[model samples]
Target: MDVIGTSGLTKRFGRVTAVDHVDLRVPAGARFGLLGPNGSGKTTLVRMLLGLVHPTSGSVELLGRAMPRHGAEVLPRVGALVEGPSAWPHLSGPANLRLLDAAGPGGRRRDRRRRVQDALERVGLGGIDRRPVRAYSLGMRQRLGIAAALLRAPELLLLDEPTNGLDPRGIGEVRDLLIALNEAGTTVVLSSHLLTEVEALCTRVGVMDGGQLVLTEDLDVLRAPTGHVLVRTPDPAAVVPLLDGQVVGRSGDALVVRGDDAAALNARLVAAGVAVSELALQRRTLEQVVLGLTGTGSDRVDGGTT
Candidate 1:
């Protein structure tokens, strides 16, 4: 069964339709990633799923239960750390978790406390679980937010920019934590604008553009095409004419080439007496493909719009 499913999910904010007839399915135990620019409806969609926002039209189902009507049933089994950490600034880390556990449904015992301790240790905050949240670093606070979410022992976890304020080490720690969670049979849906981070962590990605889901595919399919090689030569002017591919860009003495075959170009460069210092495959980035698709490039959707 799909952990989360939405069909014809639509949401409108007065004049703007934030999400339009979007369809999505997150397989159980899958590390699904949502990608888009600001105001592209990623957060809006998540809000609707979490029952924080009402949809203008359409339907949503989570874990085989219809949403809004069944949200009460579904939410209890799910955990989330959305946007930013929401713990009380004055409360100690463990105290905040204890309060959340006490308030949640069926969470009335020492087992919840033990789970909180386990979560703190899992997120690398075991040593300072007694410290006040206000005194914690940005990364520590982020970890605490994660620990609070895990206190419920949820089957589905939703994380939105969970790495927002973290340093490099913290980011890696969170990434590894999510990966481990998924491996242990927890379904994860993470939303972020960081292409490299999504590429590294997500198995499948859904790309949103102008409030619409433009593309959804596996990570391997989204990788940039490897059709050419980058070459750094002593003299670019001498080698430009002899090269078969188009010169895409110039960085210092290096030239970015795009073509069907680069082996012939390399052989030609050697025969032409051009001393090549570096030769490497030029891979397109997710940003390049997304920019091209969103009409952010020179090529406009209609005639002469830009």
Candidate 2:
């Protein structure tokens, strides 16, 4: 079943269109990643999905219910941590979660406390509940935010840049936690600037650019070889014509051919008296694929607004 769906999902702010005629679908239990450069309307689209923002046109559905109209019904099953962590600095970790749980729709006080403690344990923050929010490290704060989102045992978790300001170990911790949550049957929709993190954790990926969704596909397909072969020869100029129109371009001293059969290309090169040195299949990385799709040509793996 599709846990999240959108059609012609457009959002406009004043004269600018933040999201434009976009369509999206995320299957139940999927670890889905939404990727884009800054200002590409990723946040706006997410807001619309969560019924936090009104769309200028089109529609949104979450967990099988139409959004805005059924927000109350749908939202109870969803949890979100957008922007970054927020907590009462003077409050202990457990205390802060107690307040949030009290405000949420959870059951009795005892049930709320048990749920909060379970959430803390799930996020690896149980032992440090007594630590003041001001005393916790950035990673601890992020985990606390996650624990708060998990307090109600939500079916769908919407996290935007969940690892924005952490060290390498902290990043790995969060990554593993998300994987465990998805494995435990929680549908996750993650938006982040970290491409490697997305590539590692997401089962499916969607790319947005200029407020439009340019491409969405399975990670396996996105990471597959692009039917291109990188051939290093003594004379690229001599092999160029022999390759017919299969030659894409040259990178450094290698000729890039847009063909599946590297053996055939190498045979032809040899028949043409061109000494072949190296011939290797070229597979596109998630970063490369996204950059090509967005046309940003940026090496930095960060999201931005349009």
Q: Where does candidate 2 stray beyond 4 Å?
A: 229-280, 295-306
Candidate 2 lDDT score relative to the true structure: 0.87
Which tens-of-lDDT digit does each residue in 36-103 have in candidate 2?
88788888888899888999999998998999999878887888998788999999999999999887
Worst 10 residues of 2 by lDDT: 297-306
**Weakest 10 consecutive residues, lDDT, candidate 1?**
292-301
- Model 1 spans > 4 angstroms off: 106-108, 233-253, 257-277, 295-306
Best by lDDT: 2
lDDT of 1 by residue, 166-225 (tens): 889888988999999999989989989888888789898888887788988877776755
